[model samples]
Target: MKKFVALWLAATCSLALFSQGKPTTKPMYLSYGPTDGKNIIKFNLLGAAIRNYAFYGERMLSRKVSLILGCNFMPRGGVPYLENFTDDETLKTLEVGTFSFTPELRFYLASGYGGGFYIGPYYRFERFSLYQLSTTFDADEEEHTIDLDGSLKTHSGGIVLGCQWLVGSRKNIVLDWSILGIHGGISSGNFNGLTQETISPQDQEEIKEDIEDALDIPIIKSEVTVNDHSAHVKIKGPWAFIRGSFSIGYRF
Candidate 1:
């Protein structure tokens, strides 16, 4: 009996020790910290260099998905890179202001939600305000100058192929590279030129031709009308744009 009791006690003690050594699984709750950041705010450095102000906010949705919202504004200023858009010297005098808003849904190929190679579908709305000064001829071949003011608006949607990486020891610095993005949509706007004196029919036609000649883009079309003292130009066309950016962000 004594021997049996001793063996039983030893077995019970062993079982208890084994239970203590084995780890019990506990439920884990995800919290925001250095390892896991849920939100990010980014600035477009390249855009700023071109006199464009752009910003973006991103939120992680899942292990492989996220959402982003971006905004950009360019104050009324001289057209940047005029040589690439047109060879017309009149366009060199053109000034414009631009504003755009974009929303995107991203799917990351790797495990990380906001960092890795990503492809996203995005929608954008953009508007441009145009201003220019031009000299035209009247019926008698006299010089007349006019100031034109107008706006153009476009809506487009496309896919964005990009990659993002987290660097630094704490992984708080982010680099986002957008490889290629293309979008197409319709655009329409009107420009009005006001002059102090009444406009003649011949001068109106000349003004119309001059304005149309300045827009060298093949996809765009314009219709012009003239009243007593003002000329109106209606612009309509299929508009397309490409997006590319290398943006820096802070994850928090």
Candidate 2:
């Protein structure tokens, strides 16, 4: 009886070991998480075409949520596409540079864990610098040229809607398109102009009037002060902007 019991116990131990080493035939369902691509870096192709260097970075917080940051810089040069919109002669000699930063939170509306349509709220802080700008205004029946320089800064918040797609064999390539974005906020700036020749009292007043007249828009207000050789402009305005971009990127 003792020998039989010993053999049975050994058999039971061997069977348990074999069962523990067996592989399951159950199907696998992969879920997107930290193990998959969870971060993306992108470049704005549309902005680059217009001389604006723009870049964006995104990180997934969950299956349907992400956080993003975008930055853009345009080198000092003539205003882009200004001639296409207006024939204003005064703007022909103006040059400007721009920089902006935006932060956003995106919520995706799709079935899968990857690319899809998304709507996000974003906040933007932007700045513009005007340099070496020259404009002529007639004072005392004489054409006088004033060299002007200034900077404008604004802060705004808005919502953007867009879609993204993951491409390539491993879905590591990302294409992002921002369909539409709208923002509105306040802007303030100051510009100063200097003339080579001395300004008469009458000419100073006339210069102030001319500056004010040019800025007489329903949505914005400005104040002008003129002295013997220089003129100053203070600007306060409500500003609005529309945002759009097409970008390509890689996921990691």
Candidate 3:
């Protein structure tokens, strides 16, 4: 009887010690700390006076790295005449598209406050098309058809620098701004459609004679050879963004 009682007491004491040591953690309630890195994705809708619809995609590469791609539709206006031409004709309306890719490095000055700066190199592609319309002569009463066989396209490459700030505790909202320098070439095919028309054969003969005389000048053929075709056009300017965005993020 004594042996059985001792065995029972030992079992009960072991059970009490195990039960009182620590409570098992419930799956329902859990807690975490800040400073944990998160994966961030944000989409932005953008617009400007020159551009209509613009969209952007940003993904976090790391805690301090990101990749961005953006595109925008620009409606080109104003008919600025080229300096080589004597005519005052200007380029009319046309659709322009711009695409950019940038890999950025972000520096966080403060952890919780969400203040940072970003700078990176970028590649930009821009395309523009010119359409020819009817031309009106200064003295002629009737208009003539202008044949524009195709359009001009330009490709540019440059670098971008920018900064950003976050508002609120959750870091759900952010403000961003940027500027870029773009440089490339503008390529336009030959302009062979410009021709003079006269009602009288005598006027045609006179114009032909003038052209022949102009060609007889002693200027070097290579120097006088006018080729408006360019493989690249230099585009350098400032690109800025003032935007507010919300982001959904995940932490591992």
Candidate 4:
């Protein structure tokens, strides 16, 4: 009876092990963000074509955390409607060039590598170079030309919330969309010498109202400082944008 009991016990243990079966690979293994690797890089297609040519890259700290960095370069070009103005020795059309840098810390809700809902704090810096803007006006049956020269720079920081979607599991394509973002920052302008006359308050108000209405938002938060030689501007209070991106990347 003892021998028979021992054999039965061994047989029961074997069957239990068989039923349990070998553990399948972790489900996260199939997921990139759910499972973590090393790095992924993407380029902003729209940004490249648009005014700012931008490129972005990401490094995974963990399955749920990552850091993002981006750089943008915009070639110097004349401002809109600049052609309407004339360029000469003292008066010339204004041109602007910009370079920007951005850094962000992102948290992924559920990761394979980097997709889904994310919220992060971002800091952005932009450098701009300004040129002269010249135009002609008629006064007293005579033509008069005016030139305005200035330089402007901007810096901003705020929270950004966005969503990412991945398609084609084997290929693993990534798409990112910034649903809504808000930021407030400061902008300043300086002129070596501005020889144009300032308009009256009524004219200023009319221009401001027209600009606000056209933009669908109130701009010109404050004319921080306006002196004979230079001026400072603030762009704050309410600012928002919807940003999106389409790019390909490698997950390792």
The candidate, 1 or 3, that scores higher on TM-score is 1
Total backbone collisions for each predicted model: 0, 0, 7, 7
- Scored against the true structure, residue 148 in model 3 reaches a CA lDDT of 30
- Model 4, 1-252: lDDT tens digits are 999999999999999998889675334433454345456667666665656677778886776688989887778875544446644433335677778788988887765357778887888777777665443333346644444455556678877778776556543566777666565576655444332555445433543453344335355444333333222333334333334555555554
Query: Which sections of candidate 3 miss by over 4 Å?
Result: 1-46, 75-115, 133-141, 147-149, 180-182, 185-252
User: Against the true structure, what is each candidate's TM-score?
Assistant: 0.81, 0.82, 0.46, 0.59
For residues 150-229, what per-residue lDDT tens digits would candidate 2 score against the true structure? 99999999999999998876677889999999998889998998887878787777777877888899989888898888
lDDT for position 85 in model 2: 88
RMSD of 2: 6.3
Predicted model with the maximum lDDT = 2
Candidate 1 lDDT trough over 10 residues, lowest sum: 24-33
Cα lDDT tens digits for candidate 3, 84-196: 45453432432233433333334433332223666555555544444442222221666433333334344445555555655445554556655333344333222222434
The 10-residue segment with the lowest total lDDT in model 3: 222-231
For model 4, the stretches where C-alpha displacement exceeds 4 angstroms are 1-36, 79-94, 135-146, 169-172, 193-246
lDDT agreement of model 2 with the native: 0.85
lDDT, residue 249, candidate 3? 25
